[model samples]
Target: MNESAPQADMAEQLAASSFNTASRAIVIGGSMAGLLAAKVLSGHYEEVVIIERDEFQERPANRPGVPQDHHPHRLQDLGKGILEALFPGWREDLLAQGAYEREGKEMHLISPLAALQFPYEKDEGCSRPLLEWVIRRRVAAEPRIQVLQGHVAVSLLTKKAGSKLAVSGVEVRKQRSGGSRDLEAALVVDASGRYTRLPEWLEELGFGKPVAEILHTRLAYSTRYYRIPDSLKDRYSTVLIEGDPSLAEGSGVFSPIEGGVAETTIYGAGGHYPPVDPERYERAAAKLIHPMLAEIIAQLEPVGNPRGFRVSECRLNQYGEMPEWPSGLLAIGDSVCNFDPIYGQGISVAAAEAMEMGKALRKAAKENGPIREHELQRRFGRIILPAWWTIVVADLRWPGVTYEGSLSGRGIRFCQEYLDIVRRQALQGGDMELFGLLMGVQGLDAPPSSLFGEEAVRMVVSRSKQDAWLEKQLEAGETLGDFLERSFPVFHPASHSEANR
Candidate 1:
């Protein structure tokens, strides 16, 4: 099969159909998620309007809205596939606009135990601004989509539909003029991002607030851009040094971006924040588990001063759990859930959500049925669950991290320990398939349960008796079966056997 075949098929499916679900759809926010949502909405609506607080420029540049644009950002392979389908030739467009093509052979992952070279396919390397710019250009070219810049959505305009309030439109305000106006629409999607006011708006509209699940890791990172030396250009394009959870230190990335420059971000979880001072930043980089990043930093010429960003918590607003949801309204992207940037799951998850939304809209248009807001929200929740859990489990490894949600501390520890063994096995045993499975689940391309497959369980059980960490747990009177039963009741070995039978 041709590699481009899937993209062609997806592009054909995304093309506007003769049947229309609504006259107009309004998307709140004009970032990556909002833009993708608008692109999806364009297929099923006559007109799609994106309301953004930041004004767009012809060239790619950082804006105030995306404060973390200065740092390194990655578009996961799954997300790249989705975007290629959404806008054909987007990867080439990015390269034409100065993005770098990083092949899998150029990617390196340095763990506490070992350094692994992943021979994956080629992926684009660019800053967040350029990625957003390329996608914005694609959305701008779409005839049915209109981006309303310098405008912010103030609140939802709703009307009574039986017992529940149905969103009719949004009250938007001009950021410069401070003037407000109402724009009517058949559908309103909130992609207003991590600091969304949808929960407050819902409460004001009498629907009550959704439960907010938060995992606090207090992660902080400082980034500095450097011109890549000519001698090192042929070296590894990306190097990710994993942090030691016990020490809450030694995490950093060296990524080559566009404009012949590379961005290095040194980060720490728990309370150990990377400093913004140039001297201290170097010190932090030197202290990392690997010296590659620091050595490269010393060799490259600095392009800019160090900039810092902090993420105190990862939040998920459980809008699906609401007793009643307003019709003609939906939320996507960071409005639904936002993860720590280190995982690089945000853009990919948002793209997946938009793709799913497109599929649902197509189905609703074909059936001439009303869109089920609550059901759709629940489906989006399912899409976000694995990514959220990945971040939660990973973050819990660091000292001083705390999670307030469904999973208990013991369960989190079990997951961390299990994954630790799996990771060690994958790296030390040279099990590429197992490594890929672990990465696929983290990348949101595979379900989390894939990690609990028969092969994985066998490895875990067999390795546990010999592994020092697992031996400690076993000596503490907890068997592997007991750990599985306590940590994952629904996925106990007995249940696994029963299901297989």
Candidate 2:
């Protein structure tokens, strides 16, 4: 009799545990950010729901949610690593789906300062849609997550928590019928990207608009798909010809995608625009410092007419600085900070944000007992700020982009001098490691500190033999700042009034 009673007690305990494991979480948007967020949420929430506006296709293809999918997007080493961590073998899945290596094509980098071949990481190079779809399948397979497509999140449902408001659920509307419904959850995340309506939602909740720092990229990009020539495949090459700021052209990229197809995107800043017409695009590529892209275009057959995307500015929303920051809702990815698309930082940054959120939640659950919304907000804000700083610093170099000047003039000169040294070193001696390190920093695989290390400094100092031309500028009574301003005039901030005029 005592044995039977003990067995019954164990059964009751099991039932209780099962009941407690059903908590819910909701993530808005089903893009990379949202998928990554849902993957993280699955660890903490018993069930996670993803709300996506676009319908998913069986194979990877461009969707409406991501307007720039038509253009080439590479998963940086950091982003690829993060995806691998989230989905143990996502890289393999992508490769199996025709994702090729960065080395699939011969590559060349033509900079104003030097001409070199950029070394892309081995496990990278996939179309934007293919990468997203691969991750989507993994997220969908998670036992605790559910994908709901063709529904858009209209507003966040919040409840009064003491003097502050907390998000409790989301109100989503069907894309076709406009039918609406509310789904409750313990937490809500916005990863809706550049087209997010989170700003309006916050205003409706009585929070004055958040402060914003805008960097006017004045950038327009056009891409056309191409079928690689069989002769070129044995030696298919990708070329990056950076725009000459003095000439008003921004940048041109010819990348080989997985399917023996290449994407040529000519981009520009200021008033110079990427050509949308095929013949004009050829003219634009011909004007680049290098003739590789133009030559390649001649050999390849065009897949479709070139498509163009223009982004007026890159905006950083200071949501954390809001007078009354609300709990229950937080944003990640392009929703919080949309970088200029040329950098290829969006996917990586989104992955980083999602991973950080997961770590914070798990840590809070173990050590802090329960998550404090304000503290969570503060921590999240801090986690993303460094990466944001890195991205903005690079973007600010363009005259059309804006920044508040945390990076000083002297610092700019130091960077200019350092880059000049590295480029010179790479060109003179073909110091692959030096170029690789700079590329790594750009890929978010390493911090800028990596470039200033003793080895790097020594290599540049030894190989560069000192830049005589730059030294001459300094010798001619030019300040460090003045030298940089004169040499790379693009970095100097533009006058809005003059720009307008």
Candidate 3:
């Protein structure tokens, strides 16, 4: 048998089809990442196909593919902006579906040290199912995109292109019936998420497996829904109580979702898992740093039993580090870098990546050449770096949490200490500028380096004497600001004035 016969046949079939193969793209998975990817690809491709393993309903509801859908999820301001650009009136659509808008003042952040209220332009309080369903609906309306639910992408079909393997299409299998078929495309995106088999698929094609960076957080979440009491309905819409690592207590979030119900999720790291039992869960909530979360939980009417989800580790597949990558293949969202759910960074990060993908596609179209998959992967690495580092620094503070990656423990510890001082100063001094910057960084709206401005450095350095490591770093030959700029050079450092704005 001819080795190139399969590739030749696929090419012939694509040429004979109505649409051009060069203008077709396939996205694996139908979740947030996949749906967003399809939306972006629709602008560049004539036909965009989404292969999803789980069947989706016309209405919003939890699905098996997204186990954490029942838990509370947040869309950061940055993500909201991108979604609005992709799907006009996105927030309005969410509002029409019972989601309420939450202003900065309506949200509260309480920690053991202090309580701070930061300013945010706007955010929506909604369930993960509602968010995904809204975006999926927008994507479904795009004539160029076709979502094929209950279909699993089993493997990638590749053909040799020069010295590299070019992904020609995807081999998909029907989830319900034991049937399979090949869907040829000019590009293949692996947005199948954290459990993605892209690494295995690449290895099968003789490409060495990408290095995996793991952070074993051992985080657990127990969430229970409640009906907002009439009296409490006028209270704050969202409250987040920061977990104390010293006491091994997890964070708690109380936010209103659709259907006039509020979901409270209590999460802890390093095996400090929240309980699923009603009584035990309330007890755990009572032990939070602040009593506000517990007080609210007591007044709300319990809607459902407490449900739990556990994350053993967060993984980032370093595909860009590979010496050579397939020409026509790319990965996005969890398939690239999966974040800790506790941070609520997954959906926002996916939306941001989709926007970047769109820009890359537009550039490729202007140049009239194939998209540089390797360079695009490197760009995504840059995008994921700050978010990855932010979570790494926080998770490392937990007792049993450990990381295996290029980041050093010393650097992580230094960042943690620096952030602690900043938080204290922001809250105690009532520095809304500093607090807003902190929130912006955490929300993935601003670069992590935004927290290292001159003003922030001065504030942190003044209190650095307590920590020996920070003292040593401050006393080094280079300026404290310069040291941070060199130490964690993920994003360009923001100026104090720029950060304040």
Which scores higher on TM-score, 2 or 3? 3
Each prediction's TM-score against the native? 0.89, 0.82, 0.91
Q: CA shift at 277, candidate 3, in angstroms?
A: 0.9
Q: Model 2 residue 433 lDDT? A: 81
* Candidate ordering by TM-score (highest first): 3, 1, 2
Off by over 4 Å in 3: 1-18, 117-121, 453-456, 459-470, 474-482, 492-501
* Alpha carbon lDDT at 422, candidate 2: 78
Residue-wise lDDT of candidate 1 within 10-90, one digit each (tens)?
A: 222222334343488989998999999998898888878788888777789999989888888877666877888899999
| TM accuracy, model 1 | 0.89
lDDT of 3 by residue, 1-501 (tens): 011223333333433577777789999998999988888898888888777888677699999999989998876666777777788898889989988667554678888778866554566788999989888888878888776667788889888788767999988776766667777889999999999999999899888799989999898999999898667674757889987885787899998878888989999888888999999999998988888889988888899899999999999899989988988898999999989887877777777778777778888889987789998887777777777888899888889998999886656767787788787777876767777888788877776655765565665556543445555766547776676655664563221112111
TM-score of 3: 0.91
In model 3, how many backbone clashes occur? Answer: 0
Q: Model 2 over residues 133-182: C-alpha lDDT tens digits?
A: 88888876788876676778888888998887778878877787766776
Q: What C-alpha lDDT do the candidate models reach, one value each?
A: 0.79, 0.71, 0.80
